[model samples]
Target chain A: MKFDIGVILASGHEILSGLALTVLIWIAGSALGLGLGFIVATLRRYGGPLVNLGLAIPVEILRGTPFLVQIFLLYFGGPFIGLSLDPIPAGLLGLTVYGAAYYSEIFRAGYQSVPEGHVEAADCLGFGRIQTIRHVLLPEMALIVLPPAVNMTVILLKETALLSLITVPELTLTVQAIGSQKYAFLESLFVLALVYWALVEIAGQLGRLAEGYFSRYRTART
Target chain B: MSWKLFSLLLQASGMTILVSAFAIVAGLIIAIALSALRLSGNRLALGFVAVFVSFFRGVPLLVQLLLLFNLLPALGISLSSLSTALIGLTLCTAAYQTENLRGGFAAVPPGLIESADMLGFTPVQSFLRIKVPIALRLTFPTLISEAILILKASSLVSVVGVIELTKMASNLAASTFMPVELYAAAGLIYLAINQVVTLIGRFAEGRLPGTGVPAR
Candidate 1:
């Protein structure tokens, strides 16, 4: 009944830094995810159906299940396999791998959405394979892909909390530490929730901004 | 201890499947209701539904599940672990599904609804017969995707010691000192069940024939 402002504010200040760590993990992991997604998307497109099937299988399996178990496997189980990463690395690895699966789909959609005329025009202009992809295909897909990539970034940010379970010292873990100490489990968790809400809202806003700016750039190109 | 451990794992997997079944049913009802309320022409109801969906969908499912299982007990509404886990999964799952339903519902052109309205179809009648069927058809793949996502999320119940497959595997690993093997087996089980579900979905879509999607 007596939840003091001072106690909550002080604990909130301590846990606020967890947001920075969350963003850092998201940025690093998502960059890795994007690279892997591009390769997977390309392979799925031109590498034929069986390769697509192989690509699809991992995405389906990872997409179908909850990330919590995947994080657990990475966090606790990695040590048994001679790759004894700490919690942050394992958590990042798990989310990055999972994100790659979804991002590949987004990429494939974007790649397909690029009008055939654009690519053919590049070919007519004497651009070779790598040149066409680098100068033409990538830019066009960027307009379509940027929005969902931002969405996936927002998603991976929230998934970072699973890292807390294995003691990654992220925002949720920090909040959990305070909660268990004061036994204000609800208040402490409520704090985590609001922090997460703000984090996502900001990321979403930035995503919209990026989309707007990118669209303008594409329009200017024409 | 090994025999006891094996039995505990079986119990946990049973619990996992049971809770998942409860969640899928509960979530579908809540999602359909929320989808209706979204188009209810009531500002407050629409606003409330929008906030509920984004809030649940924004946060990680693990965090939401944790709050439900652990926090409500402190707020003087204690439930058993199974109930807490079920409610947690249902709430989050429904929130996510509402958007899918809304999108599916949205894909039915406004013209179609207007046409039905002009034909003297009452709002309720139009929604039930025209909107629901078409929306469900459009959203079949997305719905399958959501169900798979929910099944994965059921693993979080293991964290609160609800002893699902993940929990069972972890327990067996600790007792047997073979963590990797135990988790691999558990992962395989998950992958297998999911593949079955995917196949069934494909078969169902094949039978429907005119649902506007090709079966994968």
Candidate 2:
């Protein structure tokens, strides 16, 4: 009944494999989410009204619902809509789409944060639109976006835990399987918590390093 | 499936709101104390709080709920699913709100505190009369946003077998083979609740004395 660290040590390989899958899903989903968000933010900023409205409704709906519910809709409800996807793909799609909604907002904020004067300056330098975005906007936007984007990626990492319910062989699911088999619920869950804590700590340290690196540009400018 | 199902989802949504409201209020009260401790300049207390925040913030709420649900029974605690859900949510949100409140406290100008000292005000009196109000004003909008997030996150409670709105929708969908309609309705309900929260947050922001979200 008391937590048994020995049980966790015995099943270390199983837990580590689960952690690997979790990291894989997280990295893949987040990359897709960021790319999708970049496009959506750009479109929302520069596209016509219909395009804006078309993207806005889905983003709003995704943002408003819980990620668990979104997973259910995609995993359980997908078959009903003729989507017939496997758990891994379904989970990745759900995480990516859900993350995109939040990422789009962060990207939009970063896009808007670029000063108007900078764009005008780029224009005076005879920079084309694409050239201006590459030369003038992206560098500044990276500084503005890095902090929140890192936070969102951490959130996305935690969210991958929800995929366990959809039968993804992720950390939580793996732990639950071990617990049920060995009746080592305490040990398994405790190990699960530690794994996540370590991950988030590593992510936090990396985020701080990135923030410090990006802010150096501001200090140099001033 | 029927009007009865629609009404059932509505009734379950009441449970969702109840759980979220309880968790948010409980989280806020505990976070205030935690933030105070964080600002107290006691090394041991600060270290304790740092570990507490890191554990709660780092781990997923789903795992926390599972751990509490399983571990409590083993220890003879025997909490209900709803209680387990509430405890998980309260602890998790407390960590986040504590950080936000700490930021608010740090933003309080030291000059103002110095002047309060010059005016013969005690630390407690200055904190109560000046610091608390200003910090609350600065943090009110974020508090509302956190509340909204907690409301949506409360859907996770369904996993522990509480028949909250999301669970109700899944139940109806399974029983009646109406996944699309039911899930869409559930999504709409969530959207409506969040929209209302956002509107109320904006309205409250207009009345508060501090600056709000930055403009473009």
Candidate 3:
């Protein structure tokens, strides 16, 4: 069957809510990931072997492993750890931890790319570590870093579909639910896919706009 | 749970490799053409290429796979889920590879091409000898990373019932309810595969002429 108007309206409402959940996961997980990555980057930069091994292993594990399994462990392993949790939060936690390991490297790259001359100049002017990052370092590095970081964030947004297996009721989940109910699996799936297509297309356009904007003045955090 | 499932998963590993390898191979071929077209100042060629890249790169892979796998069947253009997955991945990979290869194009010094031209080399010969070699070398690491990302990301295909490593792990998880152990074991397998790929990439970098990840 083709898409019914009533179904469209109802499914659109559900998908909007699902999109909210997807965005929530993307923002919360990325923020947490960035924070964790910052700490890891700083520790590895400052500390020795213990920190090195600790940072390296997680990065490998997170980057190399299938995110599906990570989600599975969080969804099913929750009960054994004396923490009964739902799919959304558990999935968010796992993704955040995993994404953090990758983000740590990006942070490390940005931090290291700070020209020694710039740092020395800041030091010559009596600037400290935090002040150096805030004033001299991040301001310059943001241009180099924003493009890649935004690209990763776009990848993260699309990845939210994987959480449907754990029953998060995200966009894919809502669409799949409608398909099962209506027995119009292919059409419903197509509609949902188009919804995602439109959303991501908008994101790409925004990234381009931001890149162009940053290319002009280069102050704002994209 | 059984040896049968293990064998199925083992067999599916071949499909995963086949899909990813096809994507990489096709990406390289298509991107070589795109890079040539980009070398010319043809607005129509540039615009068409731009649109192609934008559409594929803008959408999520899962959606693309679904559109091909499910939607086409409805339109009476039937294909297996596995074929659909491969096509979707190849299409998307080719688009991004074009983008990277364009960067590779810029990496090739114009002087080298000019020297080739002075030596009576055709445009094609100049591209093959002077442009492509350096571009491929300059772009190898990006290609390697893309392949690795594709491999890990292919795990998402199991959701549509494609019976790969992730599907095997999921089945075992559901059957024996060994969530953590099974998933951990599966994750390690992927890590091992990725490690091997990374090693191969580094080794190849030292050998491939006019190509390499530039050290900063």
Candidate 4:
């Protein structure tokens, strides 16, 4: 079978639109995940073992299962529970929940990496708990958390491809649709791979920049 | 809750375990070779390994599956659905496991290696007796985590037409219109599998020598 690159090139506008939706979902999902992760991490840190166990169940379940199944459950099973969501919203919700499970673990590690003396120092300075968390903990955790958070973001970005499975019109779906329509399976999938690679690579470079920014104070002091 | 449907999901979960176990074993062998090559100080081998890791790590597994599924047939290499999925998962996980192993090898204290040298241990003996055990101990938890990840990721095989746990659940749901129960059950099975993996990881960590202490 002859492979044709022109088929994909001809469908640039459709692919670009799909890329836009992919990025939009990525941003929203990542934001929701970070917020939820922070809350869960805080709860795990301060909450008793029972509370921790209670919180861990959802995280464990989410982390253990595939994202594809989770989305299927939400999108297909939503109406039974009186909750209905369109494809994009369902994708966003699924990604957020999935990201939260992983990010909460990341944040928990970050929080634990903060020295005990630092918290005591905050207490000694008469800083309230919230103030200590906001000023002392968050800054320190940011340095430790950035790399993993960036990693999770990249994974999340790649996972947006799975959104295509559920009719999200994301980049992967767009490419697949084009491939089937144009009989350019090789060329279209190859392009899809390159586009995802470029996105992940960009995410990596941005992560390095953020890491450098967060660790600047440490470097300066040393 | 029909026992018949539940039994079918269990049988599908068995397929998930089979595919995942194959990938994990195969990936471990490839990862060890790649990690050894990475640490061997051979420029050509190192460069080749670097590209291999990047390509596998950089692309999404879902896309990788699509590519492997479609690209192979174009080249006149027809693979079974399970074979295609195994290749995808093994290659991807091997890349990650190589990195993890590299980190583990690095974490082994330089002083211990120097002492081994002073004791006149041969390079091969030193590596086998001293370095490998320490690295394995240090990397065991991460290896277990990776194993669990591959198990979950094996669900992507369904896209290529292999009906693993997730696929089975979806199939049963569509036919039975019981998406909620089926997906929920499938999710629980995944959780149970991961829990067992985690438990085994912890047990192995406790049993492994030279983990938090020098092998001597």
Candidate 5:
């Protein structure tokens, strides 16, 4: 069997479109996940024991199972409860919720890493709970949280490939389609692997930049 | 759901456990070998391990599975779906386990190595006896976590046509129109399996000497 770059290049238009969808889904999913994860983290922190227990069940279940199973349930099992979603929406929602579970845990760890004295100091200054959270806790946690959160983002990006399994026509599926159509399975898969590697590399570089930016205050203090 | 449906999912979970257990053990052995190669100070071996880690860790496991599924036949290396999935899972997990082991090896105290040298211990003996034990102890918790991760990831094998728990649920759901029940049951089974794994990890951690104590 011959390796042919030409075959992959010939399908560049389809590949580009698929890549666009992958990026779009990754951005939307990351945004939704981060926002929702913050909310869950906050609730877990301040919510009473009952609420914490209630939240832990779903979060643990999500973390414990495979993302593929969760998406299948949402996309296929949803109709039983009168909820139906298109492939893209289902993929986005599944990815978002799955990410939130992990992200929330990251946030919780971040919050815990902050010193207890810091919270007490805020209280001594007559800071309200919300103000302490917003002013004192968040800034400190931001530095600790960014790396893991960005890591989760990269994981979510890789997860976009799984979305192809649900027929969202993402890069993996598009390349596979081209592979079958062009009889260039190896070449097409090679293209797919390279594309995903590039995406991951880009995400990693952006993470480093964000980390450096977040730590600028400490750098300046020194 | 019906008892029969639940039992069917249970039966499928056996394959999930079988594949995941094999992958975790195989991955750890390969990871140890890779870690040894990295420590061997051979540039060629170092570069080979570096590329292997970066590629496997960078690419998604799903894509890797698909690539192997297709690429094998092209190379005239025909394999069963189970074997292909096993190979993919092992390779992917080995990359991660190798990284974790690298950290574990780094954390081994230099004083211990120096003391072993003073005691006339051969480099190989000291590494096998002193370094390997300390590193494995330091990395035990992480290794257990990696095992759970591989177990969850085992679900992806369904794509290669291995009838694991997830696939069984999908098939039964389609035929019985009980997607909700089947999927819920599948999710519960995964949760139960992972919980058992976590418990075993915790139990083993308690028994392992010097686990939580810092190396002197």
Candidate 6:
């Protein structure tokens, strides 16, 4: 009948380890998603109509369906296709692929917002194609892309909780296990909610700081 | 892969649609009320709405559902798994919809409200006839996207024991040992449902008044 903070504190060790795993997965997933997303967006932009169509289909399917289903398909279905993976690897792969679909869309929008004039201007100069992309396109895209990309990262962070369903031993599963074993469902869940809330809040603040840092670049360039 | 298994998935997709429909409608009503509370000049009401939005939006839906699934029994309020799932989804989507509605309302021109006031419309009349409609028009596309989001999110309900499309696929996969076929089929069904939602949204948007297009 009473709420007990002690219940959560008692499982501090497990909670800490779970938190570690959650952060690790989040960072790795974000890095991979961003990198892979950039590649896909580049291909979509320059790969011509047929290549764009090919890339677009998978991205749309990934965006359209639930992450839970996508992860299930990969984790459970992988074995049938001779691509078996352990739970953590499977979860990481799912998160990366899922996050990439969103990030790629963001990048594609960012690319569109960069004017054709800028590209043509870059072409007039002696800059190589890769140099033009590196020096001109990416800088322009970064300003527009940073906010949504951060938003997606926060969303992906929350998604780490879903990895618990596939038995990834992240924060959610850790708390659930503690709740069931210790008979402190309310307290454990309270802790789970608090931890997730704090994580998302921290991610948002970091996003704002990054935005500020990027805006400084904008002002300096001008 | 079998016809019977596919039928089961289809039936489960029906449940997914039903649950999402209830949540989206219920969420919109709650979101509108919450938006009203925010707009109202009462400090206590505004504070309540603020905290409600932050807590619901800050916490992930899965965690919210699990919290309700566990906390409800502790409060001596026993609910079915379906009820728990519905409550969680409705509350979660309500927070998001409230944010969208606030943005929509903010975009409503000040001139229109002032015109309504000069025309001697009651505050309530002006709100219902003018504000709500404009805000709904502005927020329509976002609302449709939110609807699709809730539909995909409904897949999480299976954790609480509701056999939605995703859950049905997992169940069939385990039984038939055909995870590839079952999950792919489930994914395709979800895509089909969302495409239908998108098409309907586009049709409704074109028909919406004041968009310079005539309704059919």
The candidate that wins on lDDT is 5
* DockQ of predicted candidate 1: 0.48
* Residue pairs in collision within model 1: A65-B152, A66-B152
Residues B1-216, candidate 6: write the lDDT tens digits: 789999999999999999999999999999988887887769999999988888888888999998999889888999889998999999999999999899777877888889999999987788778877878888899999999999999999988899899999999999899999999999999999999999999999888878222222
Error of 3 at A113 (Å): 0.9
- In order of appearance, the predictions have TM-scores of 0.88, 0.95, 0.86, 0.92, 0.96, 0.96
Candidate 6's residue-wise lDDT over A123-149, tens digit each? 999788889889889998888999999
Q: Write the per-residue lDDT of candidate 1 for residues A25-118, one digit (tens) a residue.
A: 8888999998998899989877988999988888876776567667767777788888798888887888789889889989999889877888
lDDT of 2 by residue, A80-164 (tens): 8899889999999999999999999999898898889889999999999789878788788888899999999999999999999
Q: In terms of TM-score, how similar is model 6 to the real structure?
A: 0.96
Q: Enumerate clash totals for all models, in the order shown.
A: 2, 0, 2, 0, 0, 0
Local distance difference test scores for all models: 0.80, 0.88, 0.77, 0.89, 0.92, 0.91
- The residue pairs in collision within model 3 are B137-B211, B137-B212
Candidate 4 ranges beyond 4 A from true positions: A47-51, A219-222, B107-133, B211-216
In terms of DockQ, the best-performing candidate is 5
Per-residue lDDT value at A87 in model 1: 83
Q: List the residue pairs that clash in candidate 6.
A: none
Per-residue lDDT tens digits of candidate 4, residues A68-165? 88998999988778879999999999999999999999999999988899899999999998999999888877877898999999999989999998
True-vs-predicted CA distance for residue A166, candidate 2, Å:
0.6
Per-prediction DockQ comes to 0.48, 0.77, 0.56, 0.77, 0.85, 0.81
Give the poorly placed runs of model 6, Cα more than 4 Å off: A217-222, B211-216
Interface RMSD of each: 2.0, 1.0, 2.0, 0.9, 0.8, 0.8
* Tens-digit per-residue lDDT, A1-222, candidate 3: 365535544667776887788878888988888789878887887679898888888787888887777888778866756767888888788878877887888878887877789899999999997898788877777677668777777777777877877898888788778777877677766677667777777776787788777675465443
Report the Cα lDDT for candidate 2. 0.88
TM-score of candidate 2 relative to the true fold: 0.95
What's every prediction's RMSD, in angstroms? 3.6, 2.4, 3.9, 2.8, 2.0, 2.6
Model 5: how far residue B146 lies from native, Å: 0.7
Give the residue spans of candidate 2 off by over 4 A: A219-222, B115-122, B209-216
